[model samples]
Target: MFKSLWLQTAYSRDPYPALDQDVTCDICIIGGGLAGIANAYYLAKEGKDVILVEKDTILAGATGNSTGKLTAQHDFVYAKLLKQFGLDQAKLYYGVNEQAIEFARSFAKEGEIKAADSILYSQTKHGTELLRHEMRAYETLGIPGELGKNSELPIHIDATLTMPNESQIHPVRFGQHLAQLAVEAGARIYEHSDVVLMDLKKRLLAMKSGHEIQFTELILCTHYPIEALRGLQVMKLAVDRSYIVAAEGNMPLQGQYISVDSPKRSIRTAQFDDKTFFLLSGESHTAGAESNTEVHYKRLNTDVQELYHLDTLTNRWSAQDPQTPDLIPYAGIISSSMPYVYLSTGNRKWGLSNSLANARIISDLIVGRDNNASQLYAPDRTGFGSFLLQALKISGLVVTEFTGGHLTRTNAPICTHMGCRTRWNEGDETWDCPCHGSRFRKDGSVLEGPATKPLNLK
Candidate 1:
C-alpha cells in the first residue's frame, strides 16, 4: 500500500481533543473532510454552537488524496447533463460550482496558493466531438470556456477545453486552515470520534468510546454515508477508486488536465515546501472489482514514463469516490424520514467544488435563508425511470456479492456493512467491497465506511 503524498508531506498540526464527555449542540457535523469542515466554518461563523467530529483526522479522507483542482469543469459532464436534463438544469450545475470557486477564494488570504486555467483534453475523435458539445454547454451556462486543439501536456491531444482562472490548493493546508478558522470562530472540533450508531428516538449519536452526542440537527458528510437511514437503501451509488502517483520532478503541468476518454488520466503539479512533484492520478475501477489492483499502479507508472520520461516516482495512494447515477451529488434533506436532517455524498470525484456547493446549500437551509441551489441537488430524486434502472443494476451487484460471501471458500473477509464478499486490493493492500464500497485495512479494521463495525477476522 502506498501513502498519499499530501498526507505524508503537505501540512501538519496538533491533533484536536476527542469527545470525552456527553455534550449537546445545536448541530453536529460528521466527517472531517472539506464538506464537513466547510459546513462547520459557515455554521460556526454564524455563532451557532456547532460541534464537528472525525473518525480519524481532518483531510484524512478523499480530500487528502484529492487532486485539489477547484474547477467547475468535471470532465465533459455538462454536455451529458444538457442532453438528459434541460439547459436550465445543466446551467444550474455550472452556476453552483462557480459559486463554490468564489467561496473558496474568500479564504485565499490565508492559504490559497495557485490559480490557473483548467484544461480537459481528449485523445480520440469522438472525445473531441464531446468537447465541442461541452463548449456549447459552457456557452449556455455563461461559463467562460473555449474548445481548442492545443495543450500544455506532453502527450498529443485532438482537442482541449479550458476553464480559465480555476484554482488548486494544498488540501491538507487548506483543510487545517479552515478548521483553525472554525475553531477560532467558536466551533468545537473532536478527532478520533468514531460514531458507531445513532439513537433516533433520543436524537443522539453514540460513539464507539461509550459517549453520546445529542443534537437537534445532524449533517452526515462521511464519504459513503455510513449514517445510512431509512431512505438510503434505495439510493444507487457507484463507488469508484482512483490511483495517484506523486513522482519526483519531471515534466510538470502549469495547469490541470484530464482526459475525456475512458480509463481517464488527470495531470497536475504541486509544490510542497522547496520541492515540486508531478501528480498523475487515474486508472479508476469499481471498488473490489479489479482483477488485480497492482496493475492499475503499474499502468500509471508506465504512462508516466511514456509521457514525461520521469523515472523517479516518489509516492502513491488511492481514494474512493461515491458517485451518483446521474453524476450530481445528493446534498440536502436526505429523505422524508428525516426532513430536517441534512447530508452530502456521491460527489463523482468532483468533491472539492461539490463539497463547497453542498456546504452552502446546507448552511442556507439551516439558517432559513432563500436558497436557489437546494432544489437541483435534492437527495430524494428517485422518480425517474432511468434512475430506477440504475438502482436495479446496483441492487443486483449487491445480491451477487452477498451470495459470493456464503459460497466462497477463501479466507478473505466479508464486508461488515452488508456481508458481501471482499476482493483484495494489491495496490492499497486493503479489502474493498464490490457491493457497497466499504473498505477495510489489512487487519480488518474499517478504513472508509457505510460499515460502522470491523470485520470478524476470527
Candidate 2:
C-alpha cells in the first residue's frame, strides 16, 4: 500500500478493479501503467481487441509516483550510448524517445488529453561539464541544444543546459485519460487482476482469483514480469528505489533539474489550486536493499527547508524502476522460444519517455511494421563487454547475499525472485524485500507488496 500522504492526494482518488472472470482478447497486457495503457491505446486504435490486467489500480505503480518529466534527455546517457552501442544505435535510441515526447505533446495539443505541462530544463554546477560533453555528442548527431548561465530558477548554479521542448504532466491523469481512450477504442481493462501463473507453453495466464486469460500474443508490461523467461529478466535488470517530497512553497522551483552527483536529486514544480508546489526527488538506492530510507527522506526534507524555506510537506512517495546494466531499456519480443510474448522493462527512471517509445516500437513489431527502434531495444541482443559486466555484477550480488554479513543475521531470511537468498533489512523488518521490495512478514505474509505474493519456499 502507498503512504498516507500520497493516498490522500489527488492522484490516488480513483481506483480500478482487477480482472475477476475468464476472458480472451487479441492482446493481453499485464500491467496498467503508462507502458501497458499506451500500448493498449495504440493497439485498440488499430482495431485490435486488447485486454489490460493490473494487479492493483491503473497507474498505481511507478507511473503514479513519477515526477512526470517528459523529455528525451536521459541523464548524460547519449555519450555512454554512443560509446557502447555505436552512434547509429545511439541515434535510434534518441530518435525514438524524441518521437515519444512529440507524441505526448501532440496528444495533449489535440485536446485528446489535458495539456502537458512545460518545464524549463536546467542542470546543476556539477553537471555543467557533462552538459558540454552531451551538447558535443548531440551536435555530432545534428541535434540542437544550448548552454545557459542564467535560468528562471531562484537557486544559483554555475551553468546549465536547457532543452526547450521538454515537458511534464500529471502522470496519473494522463494514464486515466489513456485508459478511457483505450476503453472507447474497444479495449477492456481489468484491475486487481493479478497474474499469478503464466503457462508459456500453453499461452495461458492464471489469475489470482482462479480466472485465466488466453491470448495469441502477450505483453509483459508489469514493471517486473512474474514469469522468468529466457535470459533471466530478474538477474538482467537491477531494481533501484527513489524517494520524493512535494510541498507548498514561497515560490516554486522554476525548472526541471537533475544532479550530476550520486543520490541524484531532481527538482521541479507543480500547481495545485492557487498554490504552487515544489517537488524534490532523489535518495535513490537498490530496491528493498536500502540501508536508510527514512534517513533519506529526512535528508530530502532538510534540503527542501534549506533551499526554499518551505515547511509544508504535503506528499511523499517512493518508486522502484528496473535499471539495465548498460542503461538502455530492453524492449521487443522476448526470444524465439517465446515469439508471441513481448516484454518492455528496464527503463531505469525514465519511464515517461521510454514507456511511450516502447509502446511505439512494440506495436510496430506486433503489427509487422518495419521499425529500427525495435532492433535497438531487442532483449536477446548482447555484446562481450556488457555481457561480462552483467554477469559479474549479478554473480557478485548473489555471492554476497550468501557469504556476506548482510544476509547471515537477518531477522527474516532474504531471497531474490530467482530463489537466491537476499540480505536482510533491520530497519524495514520485512526481509529488506529484495528483488524489488516484494516484502514479506516473518510468517511470509506480504507487507510491501510490489511482488503480488510471497516467495515460494522450495
* Per-candidate local distance difference test: 0.84, 0.73
Structure candidate 2, residue pairs in collision: 17-191, 18-191, 18-192, 18-193, 414-422
- Provide the global lDDT of candidate 2 against the true structure: 0.73
Looking at model 2, residue 248 earns an lDDT score of: 80
Question: How do the residues 1-458 of candidate 1 rate in per-residue lDDT, one tens digit apiece?
Answer: 27777778755578899999999999899999999999999999887899999988888889998888888988878878888788888888888898988887887553445887899899999998888888988888788997897587767789999998888877778778888999999999999999998876577999999999999889989876665576764347878889898788845567899999877999989875777788888988777787478888989999888878888898889888888778888888887778767878889999999998999999888888877778888787665577778877777888877787658726778788877878887778888888888888889888888887888788
TM-score of 1: 0.96
Best by TM-score: 1
Q: What are the runs in model 1 whose C-alpha is more than 4 Å off?
A: 109-111
Candidate 1, residue 115: lDDT: 84
Top-lDDT candidate index:
1
